[model samples]
Target chain A: MPEKTVTDERLLELLASEFTFEQGFALLVSAYKQRLYWHIRRIVITHEDADDALQNTFVKVYKGIAHFEGKSKLFTWMYRIATNEALSLVQQRSKHAAGTLDGNNSAALLKADPWFEGNETQLLLLNAIAGLPEKQRLVFNLRYYDEMPYEEISELLGTSVGALKASFHHAAKKIEQSIRAI
Target chain B: MSKNTGQELEELSPLLRQMREKGDGLEVPHDYFDDFDKNLKQRLTERGVRRHALRQIPVAVKRRIWPGLLVIAASLALVLGAVRHFNTGNEPAELAVLELSADDITAYITENAADFEPEQLAVLEETPDAGNQSPAPEAGKATPEKEEIPVEAVEEIIDEMTDEELAELF
Candidate 1:
């Protein structure tokens, strides 16, 4: 089912005014920071990278809140921002590393990462999932890991539901085949 | 996560279902979230101070400049009005003209003929015995040109001066 609308009118009103802006913004960050952090962490695949992206996202949200027209849920709008920031960080890092965020590199990083609690099997699955193409990888993670609904993913990614489903399906099949070969 | 039931995941792919059963391996440090808002608050406060400082600059500049600008504008208006008031009537020029004897006027016209219109020359020609050159009887000794006018030309020219024209001369 689609997520219920989460726009709080009082929060928006407080954000719109200069006097109550910080209070509203604090509440906003408290509510969404954990979710945003995990989502960015999934894309950027590092605690540090995710933290950077999350902070930048909140700064942007703070600056842009007055202009928000409430056409989409606040969570969806923020998710889109977080997604872009995380993807941008990935692209930047890939450029520096000569596009070496492949399955082997991701697996190595995951193994070294102290925050990652997964064993060998989980690491192998994550490596296979990371090996998928960028769009498929994002679709797969958001659907498989985050369990975001198709409707909400459609809103966040601006992709048709059918296209997202196809991407996710292909991604899952590829990961399965990669893991089976291993 | 609530929407994805065990049966649902199994239908999608058994491998994904197995992976789903094992939680995603990511974790944060203990009590990481406890300090997140506090750290973010510090960063935001710094940023907010910077933004507030930026927003104050133009307003401060306007405040500092406006009073001086208004004074300059008023000074310019006053100077322009004084110039206009002084220039409105050529009082000094009219007074100099009135004080001249008719003979001086005729002589000045003759000497600076290129400066006057032909109509002024015609008016000069109509002066009775304008050719006559005699000083006024009551006037003290005048310049050589003043000697050229008879007393009648001086009286006639004086009589032609309207009251408003005389007032303007004063």
Candidate 2:
């Protein structure tokens, strides 16, 4: 027999009710965990960090679900939280590596990470992407990799669509330059 | 594709275009998401238990506890007040000596000379008004005679007292 799939609206309604919150959250986690994990993994560049950020994102969603006004799609709100957690982890890693030999090379860390499975070309691409500034890298990843629309990206990031377009353009140019130099 | 992105991609070099097409090269272990979901559910359950514990204080328990809590709090406040009162009562002389400057002591003694023991009044009488100004004699009041100590001499006496001597006096 085919199991009934719950809609996001139904899930939100259940989550808002005290009796069904646990069941609603479990369903929510199962539905979105993979998408959210991949999104976080791309930003943080490590599976473990992504795992931590994913869990943190869900925990935040669970806690904040009651206050959710449903102004935006539930997934979009979760993606925003996941993005913040991933970026916060990256910022922490940058600060931790500031004085070390690693310096600001997130690509080097990604290469050394056992979970990273990129080939030489992919590594070069990653290295190029890593060299872009943080916002540009995010813009590029969301647009190019996730294939998210600029309007959606703008909503998640609170940046103007025009600004995101410019950022993605600059990010692509910089990645091209970096890849050519390599 | 958006008009802007289509134009941007058209302008990109073939290698750059291929890179963008190739996507971010990342992978996860087999059954990683399954394991992650299980662990997350476990954590959420734990969190739910904790949150439930915090908010599930029973109405009956709260009703019974409030008056007891209020009593404990009031008792604590009274104990604290009594301790403060006792401390202030026990340290009156020390606080008076430490807080009042020599001139203030002389003025206070002169104003209320009838209230003190003769020995306490004599201590004020011997310690000169270090400022060299005498309190004015009121028309109906008897002026306690002011003994003037040179300002330099008063400063020297204060400077000569060790911390131990000052503490002992207090």
Candidate 3:
């Protein structure tokens, strides 16, 4: 056991030692379990898939923890792993479900086009966001929905803040145009 | 350039202001995070199971892995056991004659039926236990295990040796 108090940071320090793999691993599971689950839940949008993806994420993290050289914070590393697992789950679920990877809500949008008739701004925003590539969609989601700063988005996506800012700018401009067109 | 701060900021920041003001996308339900946390904990548990199973195997045993590991394990147990027979350190002097010449081995088995059991000697003529990653086991069962036999002896006496003898000894 570590002589120091076992905060997450201190536990990380202990886990860095090969001698503390089990203790460190248990600590990791307990510490970030909830945060990771919620993060995955937002993307996959179903309890069953979220459950499966969450498990896969933890499994991946456990297998990959030793490879985590601590270049980033523990939560950031966990988030990255969770992100990959969630996106992969999304892709696989899309193949078997009514949704497609690129267009999960397209059918609903098409069907509800009449309902959103009064909400011209929403339609336009959707159009502009839909126009973006995958990476841009991710950047927009982090910046817009999560209200995250460029730095947090950068850490999560492993991109530079400068690049993320530029991406956000483009995304906003497109949304503006989409709304204007509506 | 001539515009006031209010007008400039309003026009430039229309999307940011309109996009639900950052903190207003959707208020999460009280149960939202709770369910997520439950699912996450369950996933962590499953991961623990897989990692625990991996940890149960000894490092040394996992090192020399092969496809036929279970069978190889059983055969190794029997072979090491037989090897321990001579290696016991307190054997009678006559029993220590496990290292005799081929002629002496056969003759001793033939003559000393009661004392020098031919069964033990016969094991010498049986096929090898089939070590992995070699061409030796390809020798048919009849070719005999001359793995312990000297290559010079095989070259001298057994010109009509089976493919197994040729493969194992030569």
Highest lDDT, which number?
1
What C-alpha lDDT does candidate 2 achieve relative to the native structure?
0.70
Query: Where does model 2 exceed 4 Å of error?
Result: A1-6, A99-104, B1-8, B11-13, B45-170
- Name the lDDT value of residue B110 in candidate 1: 72
- Global CA lDDT computed for model 1: 0.72
- Which clashing pairs does model 2 show? none
DockQ of 3: 0.04
At residue A50, candidate 1 shows an lDDT of: 81
Which of the two, 1 or 2, has more TM-score? 1
Model 3 bad stretches (over 4 Å): A1-8, A14-42, A45-48, A97-99, A102-131, B1-12, B22-32, B35-38, B44-48, B52-170
Clashes of each: 1, 0, 0
What candidate 1 gets wrong by more than 4 Å, as runs, is: A1-7, B1-7, B46-170
User: Each prediction's DockQ?
Assistant: 0.12, 0.12, 0.04
Q: Rank the candidates by lDDT, best first.
A: 1, 2, 3
Q: Is the docking of candidate 1 incorrect, acceptable, medium or high quality?
A: incorrect
Interface RMSD of 2: 10.0
lDDT of each candidate versus the true structure: 0.72, 0.70, 0.56
Encode model 3's per-residue lDDT on A5-28: one tens digit a residue. Answer: 345555554455667766776666
